[model samples]
Target: MRTIEEIKGRCFITEDGHWLWKGALRPDGRANIYAPDYTRWQGDMRTQCGTRAVWHCMHRKPVPEGYRVFGTCTEKACCNPAHVRCASEEDFGLWMRKNGNYKGKTNRILANRAIGRKRSVFTQESIAYIQTSDKTGRALARELGVSEASVSKARRGDIVVFAGAAGGMFSGLIQRGAA
Candidate 1:
């Protein structure tokens, strides 16, 4: 177990009272809490976030069941105890929504597709609509809010190979059971 003094030494208190972790950072810029034995979060090989580490140190215990420790401060790397709190995922979403950060962006296209209200760039239905609309690529591009090149590539089947979950929402090449 790492000592509290060691952990504190790896961080510095900012002018605004945020404890910025001077260690590893996740891809999203959140602090990565490093501890030898404290691995395997929810059965995944992952380190805790720094804010969660600060809360654990302050409470001298693991986070309670059915609750997640989240940062209240704007600094995602902040490990200040006063800046962290435990909440259910739903409550966390509500808090983020109240703070104007959720915006229904996560899995938004999936949710919309589930509800039959697709809000993204292209679908099979849209591609069929464009193919049968008798409009030029530029006109279809304007109608679909995409580029003319995308319309042309979509027509030529050049965009299908790149159409997957993370990106490539420009054509009707998306298939189910993709990444």
Candidate 2:
């Protein structure tokens, strides 16, 4: 059986250009199983960030010792040796929760998919209306039914806020007032 040291070579990129870390090795000199949905989360894994770190699900497991891991959130391929740590099953969960990178998923899934609860149902337009009209992202988020950060993103142009302002409305209003 091949060991992780042998798997240290690079893996092929997917059609979308995402890199996979296929070089994981087991402690007993066996080739670690590699899957397409592999997760590489970065953090201090040794302390069990909070809850039971061991995910008993069939899909996930703890990373092997001495292997460089990265945060799926940053998407940075950096393998800084100092960033690595050995985590207990519980510590890993705490780190994921406190850092808001729970389960190696991006913020989009946590918010849109509602890993814990129901998702917000506001569109960009709703956020823009709240921001411009109410002049408060927090309040607008409340009124628009989304996160304050989402409202801020809409204002900052991170997300497309459809333009609904019309010059005709101003002109018509001016004409009516004059009459």
Candidate 3:
């Protein structure tokens, strides 16, 4: 088991009182630590976030159940106990909503549409046409200005919006589970 002093030694305190971790970082750029005996049941090393490990070492207790530890400072790699805080999922969500940083479903959809990342080329009329038209998938796709896969899906009633359109060509097949 590594001592607290050894773990503390791996961090360099900044003038702003941030303990910048000089250890491995997770893919999200957060600090990670490999503790050999963090859990006794496994008797093996475990990778833990640096801030959580530092909070455990300083407080001599694990973070409260149903709570997650996060850094409060601007430095993503800081592991200072004073800069770490624990919050339940609900509390964190409330805080995010209060700060207007919560990206809920409506917000995500709006953002995606604003960036032109999610625009539906298939409208109700196009879907109806795709279902009724006897043209090949490629031809239908070319006529509709969409991909062949999209045309195929529309023909097979796989597209959600157009699948239930009344009097569509594939409506009978869709009802019979044949499409």
Best by TM-score: 1
Write down the lDDT that model 2 would get: 0.40
lDDT of 1 by residue, 1-179 (tens): 14456666788888878778889999999888754322234322236777766665566555666777889988988777778898888898889879976466757655544444233466666666766777899999987889998788777655433233444333334443354
Q: Is candidate 1 or candidate 2 better by lDDT?
A: 1
Per-model TM against the reference = 0.53, 0.23, 0.50
Ten residues in sequence with the least summed lDDT for candidate 1: 36-45
**Residues 15-132, model 3: lDDT tens digits:** 8788788888998888887654333323245678777766666655556668877777668888777788879978877765675654566655455544442256766688889999
Inter-residue clash pairs, candidate 3:
none
TM-score of 3: 0.50
1 or 2: which has the higher TM-score? 1
The clash numbers for all candidates, in the given order, read 0, 20, 0
Ranking of candidates on TM-score, top first:
1, 3, 2
Scored by CA lDDT, what does every candidate get? 0.67, 0.40, 0.69
Candidate with the larger lDDT of 2 and 3: 3
Candidate 1 vs candidate 3: which has greater lDDT?
A: 3
